[model samples]
Each structure stands twice: as structure tokens, then as C-alpha cells.
Target: MPDGYSTLHPAMHGMVNIGVRAARRAGEIMVRHLNRLESLEVIEKGRNEFVSAVDRLAEEAVIEVIRDHYPEHAILGEESGASGDHEYQWIIDPLDGTTNYLHGFPVYAVSIAVAQAGTLKHGVVYDPLRQEIFTASRGQGAQLDGRRIRVSKQISLRGALLATGFPYRITASRTDTYLDMLRAVLIETAGVRRLGSAALDLCYVAAGRVDGFWELGLQKWDIAAGTLIIREAGGRISDFNGTDAFIESGDLVAGTPKVYAALSKLLAPYARGL
Candidate 1:
């Protein structure tokens, strides 16, 4: 058993193994497609949003792995949408940073999360470029490449390094509010990073690489895996309202306990009605 797996829920052992397998398979597909980006077929899902042939192929590979091991399990894939509707569902983002991958920015990842009755049970985020795998099972604690990891010991938001994502749509309605929150954080914290991949950003928080992370307009697949990992790593996560509604609202705030509270306080006033 792995270091963190010793404390994992007994029933979750197999599920976590399956998730890691699926994520790794997807990672392989992603890396194989990297060298041939110029010839890959790409589609504009919407303004500033894209889906590539590689994304579909990777998603297919992930689902195939899950189905092979647990044919009855449900799946919610970024490229395929929801399927099966079982008590056990796999949430997948075969390529979390499509734009970054397309640009060969080397910050993308494969994210796989499992949930039972809407409650997250296990998560796996695989970075193909770095060959690092971050895993977490409910109550088991998080791990980076088989070594246990935790959130930064930073006690407060002051001087804490944070990571975030810009709303890609960039609509006029939310622009000012987002910028205001960003400006406030930039002044109060050591610095902020607008990383392209939310899945990896959350993992970085879990691994103590960054003290906190927040983002808007995220799908469940993007944050699901990272959410479990961060919680297991002893970090706190929630929406701007300081509630568990982040998954529904697509507005997230997460950090070490103290940092989370401070950041949430700073961003809440600006998130009214969001």
C-alpha cells in the first residue's frame, strides 16, 4: 500500500486505484498528442473555450479504463458530459488546460475524481509533463508522487503566495468585480499567480507550493479532484460566501485555514449575488 493509503477508507482502496489508473492512461494520451499539436484537430466550444481531438481521445481512454474495471459506475467527463448515473461516478478532466497545452505551455494535467452519492471519495491528478501524481482518498490525507503532502503552514493571508485563474470569457458584467478582488488580493498578499489549470493550482495548494487558490467559472470536473486533495492535505475550501456552494456557483476560495478565512472575507463583499 502507498503511504497515504494506509489510512484510506477500506472500500475506497479499489476506487482510488482505478482513478489513478484512469488518470495515468489519460496522461499517456496527452503526452503522446503533445508532439503533434500542429496536426491535431481543434474546435471552439465557445468564446475562448476549446476542445481538441486529443481531449476526446484522452477522455475516451480514461472512461475506457474506468469501464473496464467498473462497468456500472457513472462518469461525468469534460468532453463527454454525464453518463450512467450510478451511485459511484467518476469526474474527469482529461486535459485541464487545453489552451496551455495547445500553446505547449507545459502546465496542463489529467484530473480524475470519484464520488459516491455526490460526496467525493477519491481523487487523482496527473501531470504528464512532470510525471507527478497527486492522490487523495477521503480521510486518508493527500500525497504527491507517493509521499504525504499538506497545505502550507502559513498562518494568514498577509505575505501568502496565492494562485488563481482569470475568467476566460471576460464578460463586461463580472470584469470589474473580478479585477477589484484581484487587486485587493495582490496588495494584501505577497503575490498572485493566474495559472491556466485549476486542477493543478489546487494540487499546488495541497502540496504547499502555493499558500492558496481561487477561481471562477470552473466546472465540477476541474475542481473535484483538487478539492478532495486539498481537504485531505488540511486546507480549507469554499465559495466566496464561505460556504460549500463553490461546486454549484463555480466561484472558489481555498487556502490554509487562516488564509482561507482571510481571503474569503476579502472576496465575499464583491461576490454578492454571484
Candidate 2:
């Protein structure tokens, strides 16, 4: 299957090839460390927040394999910064939903995206516990465990299931943004879910499991790959104010064409300057 895909595309072939292998290997490292007592030993990164050694180890494990498999590809990881010299850069989030992982809530994932010359070319997001892997190449669309998937055609926010995450570390009431976002979706959508992993949330949108998503104060590593996955799966992604500055603004809104427009209008008042 890998070889078959490699022969079918050229611009993003290396990304597909390396992403699958790296995400799987990273999942292995994560699953092997699960439920172990030592893993729950966490250090405070902020008020009432913590990061376990597992997060660091997992990030290292994923980055090491990515480096070994494609020595030329640069990497920008959540736990680690950039490295390598190739034009192709891999954006990685070794452990998204860290709090959930530590609490055994089971909503974490490892995301890997490869971009060439600043544009996303391909990517993968692996949910180790469920054993589901979502992958996408720039124009090839998104897939889950090798089956193609897409965003919902839901045209109204009132009927959609929305997703979001809270941003911590820099300020108090970090959950405030999530709370506001939650309120916005709840009053209209069928439901709002804080699954704890922004990466997987985007994948869920890509797979049509969720109709839309929005968040404030997220890093590139959290949504870079997932952004491409959602976009390729027939979803629209833009800055909260409907600009193309998602990478810099750290605020993004995404959904199907119709769903996107609805969500955009709802979010417009809050994203005025950004």
C-alpha cells in the first residue's frame, strides 16, 4: 500500500512515506508507556498544570525516528524546537492532550505534518489507544486507517457538533477562551466537545465526525498538520476573523464551506483585531 501510494504522487510522496512510519513508531512508544505509575509523576508548568516525563520522552522518541528515517527533513516539535536543513519541515506534536493522557482519559495523539517551502504537503495524526491513523497529502484527501473520509456537509451551526480546547501557560482564566467558545457552540450546535486534543479534534472534523472547530492561543505544532488534513478533507480553515493568518494568529476556525461561514460570523465579533 505504501509503495502503491508512493508511485501515485510526486510532490508529497516523501511526506506520506515518512509520516506513516514515524507516527506508527511514535504510537508504539506511547502505548508501551501507558498506565505506568512513573508516568503520572508530573511537574508543574503553570498554575494547576503539569507535564510528565512521558511527554518529553515521547517527543524525543518521535523526533528521533523522524530524524533517522528522513535525515534531511527539518522538524518543529511541541517539546523541542526546529532542526535540520532541508526545505521540507515536519511539524510534530508528540503528545497532544497531555492532561488527558496523564489522567488516563484517553484522548491524546501524535501529529506529524510535512511542509515544503511553507505550504503543507502531507501529514499524519495517530491516536494510539484507538489505533486509528489519519493521513493526508496536499491534494490526495484525508483517510482514517486507510479509508478515505471527509467533513460533514452540515450547512448550519445549529446542527453541528463543535470542538475546542483551552489555552493555558501564559495567563489565568486560560479556560476562559474555551468557556466562551463552548458557550458559543452550545447555544446553537447539537453539542460541544472538549476532547482534550486539538489535533484529533481537527481530524474528527476531517473525518466528518464533527462539523466544525475553533480555538484561541494554540501553537503551530498543535494544528499545523491537522489543519491540512481538515482542509484536504473538504473543510475550510482560516483565522478566526476569516483571514489567512492562522499560523501567526494562533486563533483558527474551520468547518465545511457552509458550516465555516456560519461559524465565521459567530466568531467575527470576538476576532475583530486579529
lDDT of 2 by residue, 1-274 (tens): 3434432334445657667666767777777778594536688876745667777787787777777777777888776788877888989888888888877788899888888999888888988888787888887888887778989989998878888776664344545545665677789889877898999999999999899988887788888889889988999999976666888667888988899899989877656643
The candidate scoring highest on TM-score is 1
Deviation from native of the Cα of residue 102 in model 1, angstroms: 0.4
**Candidate 2 wrongly placed segments (more than 4 Å):** 1-12, 38-41, 170-178
Per-prediction RMSD in angstroms?
Answer: 2.9, 3.1
TM-scores for all candidates: the values are 0.94, 0.89
User: TM-score of the candidate numbered 2?
Assistant: 0.89
- Tens digit per residue, CA lDDT, model 1, 210-265: 99988887889999999999999999999887777888777899999999899988
